[model samples]
Target: MNVQMADAEITVHTAASIDRIAPEIHGHFAEHLGRCIYGGIWHADSADGDGFREDTVSLLEDLELPVLRWPGGCFADDYHWEDGVGPQDERPRRRNLFWAQGPEELPEESNSFGSDEFLELCERIGTEPYLAANVGSGSPQEAANWVEYCNYDGDTELADRRRENGREDPYGVKYWGLGNENWGCGGQMSPEQYAREYRRYATYVGTQANLMFDHDLELIACGFEGHEWNRRFLEEINEAPWGAEFPLDHLTLHHYYGRGTNVAEADEDKYDRMLAEALEMERHIERMAGAINAVATTRDIGVIIDEWGTWHPEATADNGLEQEGTVFDALSAAAVLNIFNDNSDVVTMTNIAQTVNVLQCLVETDEDDAWARPTYRVFDLYAPHKGNEAVRTSVDTPTRDVVDGDSNDELPLVNASASVGDDGTYVTVTNLDCRSAQTVDVSLEGTDLNEDDIRGEILFAEQEPDYAVTKHNADEFTADDLAVPADGSSIEVELPPSTVAAISVE
Candidate 1:
């Protein structure tokens, strides 16, 4: 299963589609699941004098994340907004039955990190706050109040209570998710039932322009699993004026990788199966988005893959909730990013499953130390591509039948996406073969850039023949960790199988 090098030429017509390209490809997500909130990003202990972590803040700022989703995966439905606000002393500590060990064993949640804290964190990081409301276990009044509490500035009962809590000014948060996975954890309801409930919530919430705050509200309707959900949601919304008038800005979808009882034991064959599943999910989204557009002819809606990442069944072990990111995780991430870039027109936003602890997190922390996982490295390498529109390019490589007994029999030898920034053009390539390196002849025919303007960097595991997810301590990486190529033209490069490489053309 090697990528055989050939001189087959593929042309990329950049000039023809340059005007169609968009610059806003960067987006992120944060959920209140596991340690993603309590210990992952909002650690009270890690806060400096300003009550914010310098390290976490610095990392988020570097990524320049455009938007972030919060306060739920499944936790949102069971979550009561009042539980995470007001006086910390008055807030009751409830048992987190989601991922915690036991009711009494769970840490005390003082309600200190409520809507205000999240908005403050988003403000500090210069990112938009995408809040998910509770619909499964909550009422429409609760949903409306949650919205008002964050966006209202008037002297209403909720607004007055918010002012009394300490903050008088409104956060003006815009993006509001109706609920998390309504088809599953959020609440296993039929599409018809969810749509009826969605209309009920939307009618009371009002439009984004009518909010008490300055910003506009963008309501997100949770579509069902696959295209059927998307079709059903649009049909129901189109039929009702309340649903159509509620400022439905985006439709949301969620997908994860791996499905075995143990992810660590998921061999290469299983990994390929996961990749195939992800590809199918991506295609399904595209089809579903098209179906929505067909019905909602007048409205402009986008797809938000708010929840996505590699999920191993063994994520929360007795040792801890965090799963160590490995080379396979990096490869999977690279593939996911490629899907996002390729489907930028429809998929507007995406966030890896859990930022720190649950799934493929960028930064994993312990009691005393923190380290960058392979997935984090992939993110760092691809960070520059955020905000840059993807350039349509052609890839030519031999496809092999490597699935063995798995579902997908064939996998491309090379997977890549190119983005042209203000100062340079960047191309990211991944070799999917788990056994051999790949030699790709990438031609920049559409642009007038010369060979001297191009440079390259690679991120392959130091260990040979094994794609185990490993963590790199702070000191393990340096400037040389990014393998930027020397000044050369038409040079032969070896990309380790199951590795990611980034090349820049200045």
Candidate 2:
């Protein structure tokens, strides 16, 4: 039997609601890299009549993912939209400049699953599509033309071409990202240089908002995690001659942790260190928000974490950036999600790295089968919080000191976030401790709760932190009934180490 060795207190401030949590906060990402596009989402051989793998599509559809960003991480920059359209056989084969793709690990793009296939997949899954345009090696005219091909409902060649390609009406893709990792893979441009390029691209892409189609597209500009770089970039973006007329809806950055800790070899100390690093997501959100408020005072640009999640050393380009999905990675996901909820007012949307067969993916697949990972369970447990109003939660939890080279850091053993909807108040809690269970006391302010009014569920209660999920054992990670003892306005639940729990009180 597991013995509880720690206690944590949580007080939900029901009245201090941040904002209606954007459903897009639960968005996902897919790139051309690895099996993510070809083998994971589509058949390994795109020439086959049924290109999409039904197993993968079913899993994604059930999750009800709000949005999916596509095309590339770095692949978007070098990609030419024209090469991906029309007949698959007639489409040009191109080299994937950044990463290898498909199950073969070849550094070439077959242009098999292109714009139409991707948008069709989104339609099948009932999820919004966010297309990132090429800005590195491609020109603004190309970016604008791609947008027209996908969104324009006119008599133009691009629009007619889209019809000829079988999509009679425009896909009406709403989220248009200008670039990806401009300071790195997208382009080796400096902050000022990228900002100028952003303006030039926006001149074509953003201006088409009223002229092109009925879809009022939201333009996303990629930013750097380095706070100073963001500050300088925003400063130059403010230099646009259009001034406040410069079109920008969201500023994005990528955050991937666990690069140092390999789950296969990590011990308890390494887990603590990784959790600490995950908690740093709060700092990134604050820093990005600060940069926006300080520099773009006149614009209401939201913050976006378009690319994020675990990128352990185990996941490299050689192997399609695939890593074993474990309970530890899922725990970190819950922590980062809580941070997103707390900052929902500014955090408009976030996409977890690769949706399938990639780093910290929610779903994993093989030739015969596909299954949900532990991280998928975490998203399932927290699904109720999506689109609900996120309220403030004060957590008083025990901490463990972790040794990080020259400095020491403390990792809280428990983390949580709460949201309120018409159904009731929902609370999610995570036990960050990997060694022992934690007894948690939750109090919903100004609300009376009885055992009959509450429904609770938990995940990974029977598993260890480093337990990697596989196809045969994936069902073991699903949420099970959690026994919560409630009295008056308080509830007490014992959370197993590295486990996640959710409570819905009516």
TM-score, one value per model: 0.88, 0.98
Q: Residue 505 error for model 1, in Å?
A: 1.4
Write one digit per residue (lDDT tens) for candidate 1, span 64-141. Answer: 667777876777778888887766656676645454521122533545567777888888888888888899999889
Report the alpha-carbon TM-score of model 2 versus the true structure.
0.98
Q: lDDT for model 1, on a 0 to 1 scale?
A: 0.67
What range of 10 consecutive residues in model 2 has the weakest lDDT sum? 1-10
Q: Count backbone clashes in candidate 2.
A: 0
CA RMSD for every model? Answer: 3.8, 1.8
What is the Å distance of residue 375 in model 2 from its true position? 0.6
